[model samples]
Target: MRRIAMVTLAAGVLITTFSLTTTPADAAVGFWRTVGLSGVDAFGFYDTQAAKVTLTFDLKDTKKDGYSAALRFTFTGTKKQKDDVRVVALTGDRLQDKWQTVTSTRLKHMYVQECRGTWKKSKFTIKKCGAWRRHY
Candidate 1:
């Protein structure tokens, strides 16, 4: 009985040691909202497991007249994070242009900041602004 107890204690110590020495894999998945024109808004999520991201920058406008107004999708982060960046943009003729998701093996971050702009044409000019969430 004493021998069995000793063996169990040793096994427990070994398991604890292994667990402490192991490092956890980073597998954080998060999403951000994009508010654009009536039909130009979108949302995206990213995985932070690998060093490279598969869907880094991608946007699509299913609205027949996505170009009727300007749209903007900005990436956001906490104040400590790097400067906010534009992940997707659409305007003028490009608004109606075909845009697809592109995989990038660059940039790795835990969190991202996001904002969207709606295109309310004024005198036939596309205008985008605001940091709010909207369903396209």
Candidate 2:
């Protein structure tokens, strides 16, 4: 009886571990873009389960030209009604990788625009923007 109970416990633990690591069928989808310009890359995913958008930027400019990266998220509701724009920016060292998240719910259509900009007087002025791409 003791051996049977131990075996049963081990089986239970194995099943639980596998289940925890398994990804759900509705797992979030990811997107990535790489700009030919020196040191500009952005990528991330929208997690429907968490109702959040994650944006990551890997920026590096050898000249340290005050270059910054940003993500413009446009969310629309079920009726395709435009909601609002959420902008997340990353700035600091010339070579830096950072990510930011915005919690958005009830989104039917989601679009993201990756932008490269400069910092001027504690403000980020977008110099250029990639075409707005649909994420969801």
Candidate 3:
């Protein structure tokens, strides 16, 4: 009886450890649009039909440092449609890249990023501009 109980406890412990290791991470970043400026409208319009946005994630290494991930977005024109494509990139510590850690995790991929960057058009740069985020 003692041996059976010990084995059962061991199995339970192993199962718990395996479950924790297999659990996914959190990739819930938000997205938004950069509106109002000259190129803003263009980007917005392009956003309406279809546009390509690149996302780079800078994460921490397994040593609890920092790294990155990326994704491409193809927006289909419609009223509040959801984008289903996903991509990611990783850099920094090979033994422990946060990119992969969060890759399996899900994210909120579409929202408007607050303005700090600018919009660049032909011979012009729209200052005080913002970019959009992805909604997953």
Candidate 4:
């Protein structure tokens, strides 16, 4: 009786451990909303087939200051194939493009004294007034 009870307990523990480490089927969805002094822009849609992101930049009044260029981009990072999840980071010239882990803190903390930048590609444009973060 004692041995049978111990075996049942061990099986239960194994099952519980497996369940706890398992991520949900849709756990990799990525979404984000951007807030700046110019206004608020939201972008992203759920995709369970793969991890994807839709981005929107509003250049509404920025053109008059010689920086008016708005863009909407939808891009999916390269998946590992074995896993359906994808991850991307903004670096190099793309650093000014959007909020990455390092750049976001500077923007959010109001450390930008003077921003001198230009958009080389529509996909990489900077918002002077606010910070952006991943919604997911």
Each candidate structure's TM-score, on Cα atoms with residue i matched to residue i, is 0.38, 0.66, 0.25, 0.28
Model number with the top lDDT: 2
Worst 10 residues of 1 by lDDT: 108-117
Ten-residue stretch with the least lDDT total in model 3 = 40-49
TM-score, cand. 2: 0.66
TM-score of 4: 0.28
lDDT of 1 by residue, 20-135 (tens): 97645754555655543455544566554445443343454446543432333333334665633334445433445433453333343323223233445533333434454422
Q: Which stretches of candidate 2 lie over 4 Å from their true place?
A: 1-3, 22-38, 50-63
lDDT of 3 by residue, 11-129 (tens): 99999999886624422233333334322211221111123333433332122222222223433334555545433323322433332222211122334332212123322221243
Task: Single out the weakest 10-residue window by summed lDDT for candidate 4.
Answer: 105-114
Compared with the true structure, model 3 gives a TM-score of 0.25
Q: Tens digit of lDDT per residue, candidate 4, span 71-120? A: 22222233432222212323233213343221111110111111222355
| Candidate 1: segments with Cα more than 4 A from true spot | 1-24, 31-36, 49-58, 64-81, 90-126, 133-136
Better of 1 and 3 by lDDT: 1
lDDT of 2: 0.66
Which candidate gets the maximum TM-score versus the true structure?
A: 2
lDDT of 2 by residue, 2-97 (tens): 999999999999999999987677566556554444445666655665554444444333335666766677877766555878766676537566
